[model samples]
Target chain A: MKKCSQCQNNLNYNCETCILRLSGKTLFYNVPSSLLQEIEHVDEHISINTKIYEENESNTYLYSITKGIVKLSITDASYKTRATSLLTAGMSFGLEVINKSSYLQNATSITPVKVCKIKLAREQINESKSLLENTLKKWQENITNQNQIIEKFSMGDTHTRIIRLFHYLKENSPLEEKNNFYLPRLEDISSIVNVSKENCSRALSKIKKMKEIILVDKKSKIYKT
Target chain B: MKKCSQCQNNLNYNCETCILRLSGKTLFYNVPSSLLQEIEHVDEHISINTKIYEENESNTYLYSITKGIVKLSITDASYKTRATSLLTAGMSFGLEVINKSSYLQNATSITPVKVCKIKLAREQINESKSLLENTLKKWQENITNQNQIIEKFSMGDTHTRIIRLFHYLKENSPLEEKNNFYLPRLEDISSIVNVSKENCSRALSKIKKMKEIILVDKKSKIYKT
Candidate 1:
């Protein structure tokens, strides 16, 4: 088993090569390296369809995705589930702990996933400048992303919404893997775009006829044309 | 003209009586009174339909509403304008400067409005603990609000969307004025809810028949049944 050089731990990912530490796109990109060393984190592998956390669960740690995909969703008062976002490698979730005690949404793994869960101390975050700034930055991005999704999906018809969703997914795919993007199942995509599964399939057919997206695997992989 | 006791300034709305300082609903409610005195601001009464700020304009000062209403909106790439949010008395705008130098949305007065344009120093914000925490709080609320608007309006049908929008407007109405809510024109409400004007009118009529909302003015004011 390979060991981490910085923390001298027998793990696939450690503080030195942690996605939060290595990826500039992460919420902790600007957080000081020394401060990261002071924080405690562990890498864990989970199978597909596992619920990482449930809504209203006490938020105590920040989850960073080192591999695979995770879907964040919320169940409305009417009992309808809506997917808010899909997090891939280098993206982090659970920063809600910085401001709120409970998770506002359910995070479920869409694929077999690897995550580095970092234990967060409220006192430590309040005292650190970089940590606070990064947290605020994450908040800013969160709002911007929500707005983008609303504009892209809500304003358009089903077909238009599907096209826009594909573009967004392509743009937000893991930094290094841009050409061939990972797509969730059609049922999942339907939920994210707020449409029925049949309508989503119809729209996908129309979009495919237009040569907008070429489905590589007919299930999970797509390449933008 | 009344004089502000704190700054000895002859202004109708001054630091001593500023909405930001007086209202618990405001972003600046927790900011120290000593810091409020240190900040520079001016009271400006803008005419209805006046543009407060343009999208992409350099953000300089935080605009706190002392009276009346302001609509914040964004124009997408297709030139379609969407109303993102409506700000009323005690609410503030222009906090986007905390993370970025440019305003992401346009702010325009929906009614004859009074605003306290408080000059913000980026360096000062970074230096103060309370200011940072408040800013973070604002961001958290922003995300929560966006998600709420999405789930409420985006997921449901046009009729459902209008009902949800009314409930949201009722909930978000100026703190003291809950029973009688000030609503914008049907045209504006239609845009905010992402529905066509005709459809919005139709759904509103249905809602009105059901006593979901009683239109007091047949235009601007509504009473929830």
Candidate 2:
């Protein structure tokens, strides 16, 4: 079994705090603790669906989630929102601050989110090797995720895309189950998959009939083999 | 009149070598000359359609083209390729070396490509502040490009996507042309627009009928107003 996020115990239980401590995959992962301590930070609590930052507008602060999910998205000229990626605990948002450019995507709270907002400074990034490395690492990870999404869309029908979408959510979410887990609401899933709500529902039903997903609740389910 | 790539004079000639020196928007921009000179580098010549590197596999050397075009693409499970971005002169490739992970996109030479391949060494990166800064800058530029792509697809129809593709190419190229430019094969345009070849052809014909484009040669054209 894979190691647990919190205690590394390899047991199934809701360990929400595990995501916070196991942020080895985040920007703070390899940074010097002293530097982290010296930085200015604010603890922010946001309601579900709250807008954290708008694309190409905000650049004052960088953020790291301690609880809940933040979905990074982009809106076209027509104001069509495309879900770029999901930011769970340990993932840092507002990373474009390093380049001192405009935000590339919008950040929105997917659930009730708790985040630590840090004042962004170029000096901090210049002096910290670990910080720069982690930022590049995250950028690389985002690129990989984008390619994977493109891959899914390029080859799959609606049903296949929906299955991959669920697999994607489970992969990004905080772990608590072996085969069973909860997901964002259908609308969120539809936004990520870039399909209509009806199409998304149809795909979900198809997956259910195929015995690929066992419904545990309206938003929770099992990835049945 | 637009400034020439080499002499800054208004001219109407192809400057094949001009892009090599005019790289203000690339990673090498703002970097010290001595640091660049100290690095071990090799000049490589790639034929058209040569595979520079495959996505999710190659991580051998970092590359920057001096001439021609390199298209970054992603191939799905069914081996269908979608062009993600164009890496022109000054723009670099093989950046996944920073993350020490798999490549996020395939780098394919769309023309006869002149490239400088460098073996990325961590010691060199850690010691030079310039290298790290340039890399970060490139990452930020890439994020911006990705957002632009998302914006284009999300907002516009296929015709607009084709127009934006041309605009994007003009923006990234070395020289500024007011109403004329050469393009890659229709297949390349089709790949970039994520549309079928017949659809791309239909869009091209529509634009031609709309007097937005004037056919010159098979690959060269005039963007008529």
Candidate 3:
């Protein structure tokens, strides 16, 4: 494991504290300390820019964001793509690889990013073992969150839906100041809410006019009033 | 655990072959045989006419159907109830307990139901553990099926929605069919499709006229043509 030079931090990732703050549970809770030690030995840090996983490609490594943001997305046959969700510092991705051989969604870094990659073949992690139960629980939460989004789309009107999304971000986003929680690009937000970009733009305009939310830096950042 | 006297059958809640078939690769592939042995010990058998869990009551058990059918429903304040899903032999229920302290749905035996009940106190059988990974995979599949139902309601027109429900039942129902599977009650179908009883009735009439489905035993049962 890469240790911080000054503090000699032995952990594989820095986001554990932030993750615990957001989830009230750490991903490494059930992980055996010995196994963590083993992981620390083999963990490698990689830096990548822009597109990371190619379409229809199999992801061989599980990644945790160490520095910047990663965007997860899926594309249709018509080449229309939607951002599924976003991963940032301290968050993990490529969990869908646990059940399937290939990655179902594409992940790309929003900025030059640092990620700690763990090779699946390096460790014999059993999906059914208690050693990884915490990880499984994390995945289960992800699935539930996805389901909730589906429910919101199903039950809520457009304005209600947008408000629900805002509420969700406010509740779950790592940033404490509502204004510091940077919103994804308009296209990414459109894909997540299952709205056309024009509709998403219109909805944002309405929300801004109503003073429910404010935009900053030419609409790249968003904050609640 | 209950055992059959003559056949020496271990009365576990899951039919081994049925679980393997239904869960397919999702849960079956990575599960170790030793983990399966642990699951076999956790099985509890209950007889017919038994109430497993009541609506709004604290949920304490995760059940799998080993022998007979189970009727899962929810009751409102007025005691007006609706069946959500009819879990047949080998299907699992009582998953609402995962996120909540109580059950949202009530479960009762439809036939001489034999269930393998996993008690909440047993830390030995962690649902997130590798031993029950197959079981969790099956549960995720159930969630996916639920998502499809929600998608149907969100995106499809009424006629198309009803057709999708029919198709879903035809694909997932466990009942044996010479020509077509029979749905025993309108209320059960209505709940699954998220349609009103009246709408289900009207849709049935339309489908019958289209020769897409036929009713059996008045309105008590239905079969696709």
TM-score (second chain) of model 2: 0.73
Clashing pairs in 3: A1-A40, A128-B129, A128-B130, A128-B131, A129-B130, B13-B66
Whose DockQ is greatest here?
2
The number of clashing residue pairs in model 3 is 6
Question: Model 3: which docking level applies?
Answer: incorrect
> What's the CA error at residue A136 for candidate 2, in Å?
2.1
What tens digits encode model 2's per-residue C-alpha lDDT throughout A112-189?
666767775656766677776777777676666566566764346777777776665566544455555455567777
Ranking by DockQ: 2, 1, 3
Interface RMSD of each: 2.6, 2.2, 7.0
Residues A1-225, model 3: lDDT tens digits: 657433454645543333442443534445555555555323333333356685458867666665556766666433656554555565666654555546556777653455666554313455324434545455545444443444444234467667766665655444545544446567666766777788888887898799787655454454654
- lDDT of all the models against the reference? 0.69, 0.67, 0.54
**lDDT at B96, model 2:** 83
Q: Which 10 successive residues of model 2 chain A have the least lDDT summed?
A: A9-18
- Across A157-182, the per-residue lDDT of candidate 1 in tens digits comes to 78877777666656655525565565
Candidate with maximal TM-score: 1
Residues B57-146 of candidate 1: C-alpha lDDT, one tens digit per residue:
986777877777777877765667677676667767777776656887788876567777878765556655667666666666555654
Interface RMSD of 2: 2.2
Chain B vs. true chain B: TM-score per candidate: 0.74, 0.73, 0.60
